[model samples]
Target: MKELMKGNEAFAEAAIRAGCRFFAGYPITPQSEVLEYLSRRMPEVGGVFIQSESELAGISMVYGAAAAGFRAMTSSSGPGYSLLQEGISYIASAELPCVVMDVMRYGSGLGDIFTGQSDYWQAVYNGGHGDYRTIVYAPSSVQEMADLTVMAFGKAEERRNPVTILSDASISQMMAPVELPAMACHDPDAPAWALKGKGNGHFKRHTSVMYYMNEYDGYVRAKYEKIEKEDQRWESLETEDAEIVLVAYGISSRICEEAMRSARAQGRRVGLIRPISLYPYPVNAFDGLAPRAFLSVEMSALGQMARDVALACGMRAPVYSMLGGTRLYSCSDVEARIGEILGAAHGAF
Candidate 1:
């Protein structure tokens, strides 16, 4: 069975399918539909839905709910996400598990109700005040938006870490028919690894870093190092002997994909690496690209992931980027940039 659903609504449905019983959030577009959709459905299913005072308070409540050990989540956009980073870091530090869906819009300040992948760095790089890390899943389509949100909860708890669903305005607003997956009686969203509550179990203690250099320095490095070791994923398209590659995640990857198709029409051999998980970024994936590959790092932001890709690729090939401009990106934009990179591709290998 399939139904045409908004990306945000699908995300809520997917959380339900994943057995997410507790949701705490502050609404902000274009992700507000997700928050609003869940608000009604959760109570109908005997789940708890909380609309908190602010993004900070919302995630703080999420922290409490997650501490109590219910498969929990929250949703927001760029500005809202900025507000929630404090709690996100706290959740990461305490090693409490939760899922967050950042249905991004175009903005570094204020807010734009339009499409963009500008939050790529903020979501993956742990854009909070202190040192922290989380797993980020970028979804290109509405179906993926729903499915990824559900999977994020499971993966977050599996690692006893936070998992993020990264979708953009286009995907969130687009209507698509998504087939919901059937779930078993036993829900995997809330796993045995988390501390549910003190009801059947003993009370739990939660704490955050107090910034003692002597006490926290080594632990910080170890946690960050551990994060770097796990949670990296990428998808290879036409990668076999592909000389020049386009690297992107989220909605930008969709454009890159179409660009590859167009380039192929003109008989240009282009490849793409669409990273699914942003943190513990797929560095090794780029390393294995064909020698002539100069990674075209595409995003709607000002060269955030590009810098990371360059660090990952080193001198194997140049890492070029097309970033920071108004308006939604398209396959034509990708084609032009890729044409530029290919023009200079020969000597780099």
Candidate 2:
């Protein structure tokens, strides 16, 4: 059944249905509803819910729960997410499978409670210390917020690492129709590496940076290469014969989609490439695309994703950026920007 739901509520419900039995998080703007919804619902299904005093403690709790082989989760926004990075690093080093939601907000330290995508670098690059990467999912709509949360758990476990659902207050606070799945059942058997009850007189210690630290980098690199090859996902629109291709994701992609439509209507050959997995980044989306120009639209002062786009496209085409901080861009604003780039490139061709 389809229901009109806010983005936070949708992911919370989806997590519960995806067998997430433990939730630990503090109240933070934009994502507080996720904690609120899970607080009441987790207990109904015999799951554990914790209202940690701080985001640090909350993510720590998640690490503990996941260590015990339970599907665990935590949610927060920008500043709070930064505080939890230490725990996230530990979880990554220990190779624990868990889910984290970052409902992005604008600015740094005590920034506004409004929506922003400034955390793209934090989410896709150095989320924490060390040479580690978390699978990052960028959900543009309420339905994706829920659907991706469910998929995150599977991906995390399949890869035996943490996964981040990267979203912003805009999508978190907005309401949209979503079709939820049935509740999932937990697996009875704990993972072989988990610190479960004594097994055959063997002791298990879940430590950060698995034994043989020297070989750790090689191991992680192999996994990341596999992820890059196997997990890259994206959506492309009208790029077969286009002069400009817009690279965007999350909430910004929605605006760019509108811009693409308007540009097409104006007889401008424009297209879009929206990355669903921000960490893997879907670099192949631009492979072999002979566009006249590439524009990256993002909700941040710095063009974080633009750097990724330039790297992905190997600077095959001139790359441009349209930045939006706290406020989102309108279709017309993006349309105008696309026109500007295309017009400038017209003379070069």
Q: Which candidate comes out best when scored by lDDT?
A: 2
Q: Quote the positional error of residue 116 for candidate 1 in Å.
A: 1.4
| Candidate 1 C-alpha lDDT tens digits along 1-349 | 8999998898888888887888888878798988788889999878889998899998998888787677788989999999989998899877788988898888789857788778877898878866677888888888887778777877877777788888888788889999876652325334444454467767656766444246686777776677677667778888777767788887788878888888988888888888887887888777666546555555565777887777777757777887744755667877887777777665331
Question: Clashing pairs in model 2?
Answer: none
Q: Which residue runs does candidate 2 get wrong by more than 4 Å?
A: none
Q: Estimate candidate 1's alpha-carbon lDDT, on a 0 to 1 scale.
A: 0.79
- lDDT score for residue 188 of model 2: 28
Residues 194-222, model 2: lDDT tens digits: 67777688777777765757887678889
Clashes of 2: 0
Error of 1 at 264 (Å): 1.2
True-vs-predicted CA distance for residue 70, candidate 2, Å: 0.3
Off by over 4 Å in 1: 184-203, 209-227, 346-349
User: Evaluated with TM-score, which candidate comes out highest?
Assistant: 2
lDDT of each: 0.79, 0.90
